[model samples]
Target: MKHIRNFCIIAHIDHGKSTLADRLLEHTKTIGERDMMNQVLDDMDLEREKGITIKSHAIQINYPYKGEEYTLNLIDTPGHVDFSYEVSRALAACEGALLLVDASQGIQAQTISNLYLALDNDLEIIPVINKIDMDGAMIPEVTDQIIDLIGCKQEDILLASGKSGIGIEAILAAIVERIPAPKGDENGQLQALIFDSVFNSFRGIIIYYRILNGSIKKGDKIQFASTGQEYFADEIGVLKLTMTPKPEVKCGDVGYLITGIKVAKEVKVGDTITLANNPAPMIKGFEEVKPMVFAGIFPVNTDDFAELRDCMEKLQLNDASLTFELETSQALGFGFRCGFLGLLHMEIIQERLEREFNQTVITTVPNVSFIAYTSKGDKIIVNNPAEMPDPTKLDRIEEPFIKAQIITLPDYIGNIMTLCLGKRGILINQSYLTTTRVELTFEMPLTEIVFDFYDKLKSQTRGYASFDYSPIGYREADIIKMDILLNGDKVDALSALIHRSRAQDFGRKLCEKLKELVPRQQFQIVIQAAIGAKILARENISAMRKDVTAKCYGGDISRKRKLLEKQKEGKKRMRQIGNVEVPQEAFLAVLKLD
Candidate 1:
């Protein structure tokens, strides 16, 4: 067996993890002059556009050091907290981690969280401070913080600039000397854990597995430890850090296992790939992640619903991180309730689904928590407008909250404080990085941050802020289940709960934002913003001035009269209790507003 060092590069979002990987690929001569691709591990176009890592990817390169060749299996993982579950899975496939800390920014909340996870895995960590080429770099201070906070040896932390190729050779030397080789039972049964897989149109399901023990080659039968289904290995190959048609991989190797499989339901992440005739005990440390945020996704054009469904299913084949179910709303005809790891993950998934599937969609406001209301003997899972109960019928409603950690420069601290206070934020504590940057922790309701909160924060900070959050304990705050009534009936798609003090303002803002989003109604549409007993604001939509004027009841006068009668009847069905002609878009618009 070859000397293999399997490791993953982990850091906070945009700390140069991808850039470091790119530098390594170039430094080790893994890419040729003709290859000409930048940030090769960021293979997906969608990932680059968003400036975030959405998936866990890997590559292999052979580096020569001290007259010897060492095989480096480099795994790249998402740094965002939403995708932390995937990060754990990726960590399971590696023996060590290269923790990248930005020289200018120093340690962050995400960096601490990621470091804690690595420690739990018992993985050897090699700290490397990156971005040394930038102005105001502080390599020694960050190195001191790593040693003081993490209690690691001072010499173990390497300093480098991933962007300028500075200290890259030293990083390679540290990897060869500090990180250990892979170890497993050489004589045990042929067992492996399938961390990730991909289904190509031509090659079928290309399963990626790390061999735990024993060995198998072409013609050997393998059984899925989870499903007990068996298949023959038609082909086996390693993802060449640098070429197509990857080389064949064997035991103690991290590579792709092609079984000539065509079924999507058969292969799953976290499944076990073992010999068909013999099996071993399952690995001890795998955990299923529960989604923390959700939203409703629907095709802009109803005709494309089927296409959207197919694309979602196809995307789910590779990304087991996403969750969805068939859902419907009075405002939206039919759609799927999609679950995501976090806000960024939710946006990335939506963007990829649209671009890859060629489908345009209308997405609801992303929700951070699913409130459950139990009043009297009734039980309700309040997620949408229809599920929201009347205020009088409710006894108590439970909402989810989050523990948010923000890292930012000192200049915008006052603005962030004001914005958080407006969202009913409670201060937790504060820490500082030297004297310039501060780590401010806050206990904010998840619902407040899911909406325009992110955009608002970015605007206030001039894009200098970074955020990470996790679920905190639930709290009982003043909650009101507000319902939106179109005319006289309730609209499920436009239902939400707001604090008593903000109910009127929330309603008014929602109505206004809706007016801006939705087009004019065919008939004179009336938009009224109302609280329980009083109307706060009202707008008069002009009547359908030009529509139906041309060829009015021309040929087939009876049919024309019938149509006009139907239109009038439709108008009557609309509630005119307060001289308001509520259009369909009004409900949709309200749903998207706050």
Candidate 2:
């Protein structure tokens, strides 16, 4: 127990967390030089392509410090705000954390957020300043920032460059000396916490856990505290780049467990595992994760519903945060209403479905849950805009709100304030981190930021501003559902809930954009935006016309007039009978509008 060290790396996106993990692995010789790859822990292709971490990965490493062998269980976590829940779970399973900050970029929004998460878990933190090899590195300033943020001594902070393998040995020594070894009773009843799980076609569910007390062997019967399902432990091993089977995993050790249970849903993250016959008390678990964004995902072909569902089920085994339910749409046909942690989460899931499962899916715009109160004093919560009650029947409507924190340079503070205020954001407070950097806090509607707020902020600040947000509950506001009508027919997928004050401008812009995107047909198309019976904006797409007089060659003037009049009547009839066929691009146009 004294030689075991369990810790995780936490930092903001692109803050050298992955780079440092690679250096650590190399220094420990866990992966030979021939087998090492860039961002080894980021196993997903999407993660490498986007230069971000989506899932947390765990690995064990052996290091020799001052002639003493130490076993280090290192868990690498995602730094994005969307995966905060995953980070929290990883922190709970560890005894210490390495909080890395970029020397060039200094402290960021996620850096502060992750630090707080570690502090809340009561884990010892070792602050490290990375990226010191860069030309723009500001070591002294960042060291001061860390001192101010966490009140740690300046000498305690380690400065190193992950790109050049500087100070790697010192970091290893610090881990063994600073981080306390795992403490548990070896003879106590068996207890373990499941931090992650994956499905194997041949072996069933493979669970990743850390034993809190007692020992688990290959033949022992184990049960899940949450599900109350029992199964024989078919295999037990440690993850060292690969699964290496062992006879037993003793207390204070981290490893994987394979149960004969074939059902993927039986194993869950954050669940407790213990001996079946002499079960111990369940350990304290983390809070259940609730999704913040909801969107409807439908297969491009209706025949692929079962395939899509199967794909979702398999993916859910790896990602416990993902949620979905069967739903039918008149415009989109049969699909699932899915809930996600954020826009990034929704994008990752969609990308995985298409790339890994080879299934084509169409996703509606993401929305936050809304509360609707009817005149009869009936309360309802709506996740989809199509399910919203009639305007005449509802008395009041409330939308989810968020408390957003923005960190940027003082030079761009004015531009950020203007953007937030434009989105119906109420300024809560503003403070200065330094003479040149500032932090701004605001209370804003979740719907306003779900679409293009981040993009607009990046554009305005020149990619210097960092943002983080959390739900602040619901607030009553003046909002209305704006519907898009194509040739007098409402398109349910194109409807959205927008603030009343900006409805006219939004509606006019949407109608104009749709007119440019919708393909021209044989008959004229009238695109209208209405808030109930009143049409706020309209645009006319002229029909494609053919020259009726082209066939006339040296005809009488009376005959030409008759042909033109007959063509006019035919066009009017076609316009009345024509149905506007809105392309998929038209439904997606509203999402691109500013």
Which ranges in model 1 have alpha carbons more than 4 Å from their true place? Answer: 242-248, 376-380, 389-393, 489-491, 529-537, 544-594
The regions of model 2 sitting more than 4 angstroms off are 260-262, 553-579
Question: Model-by-model lDDT, in order?
Answer: 0.76, 0.89
lDDT of 2 by residue, 1-594 (tens): 888999999998889988899999998899998989999988889999998988989999999888989899999999999899889989988999999999999999999999999999889999999999999999989998999999999988998888899989889989999999888999999989999887777887789999888999999988999888889988999989989999999888899998766766787888889999998877885788888888888888899998899888888878888889998887888999998988889889999999888988888767888999999999999888787898889999999999999999998998999999999999999999977679999999998988889889989999999999989899898878888888888888788888899889989999999888888987788999999989999999998988888888895898889988998898889988877776777656667887
Each candidate: how many clashes?
Answer: 3, 0
Candidate 1 C-alpha lDDT tens digits along 94-159: 888999999887887678889888989888899999998889788788888889778888877888
Leading candidate by lDDT:
2
Model 2, TM vs. native: 0.95
Model 2 residue 219 CA deviation in Å: 2.6
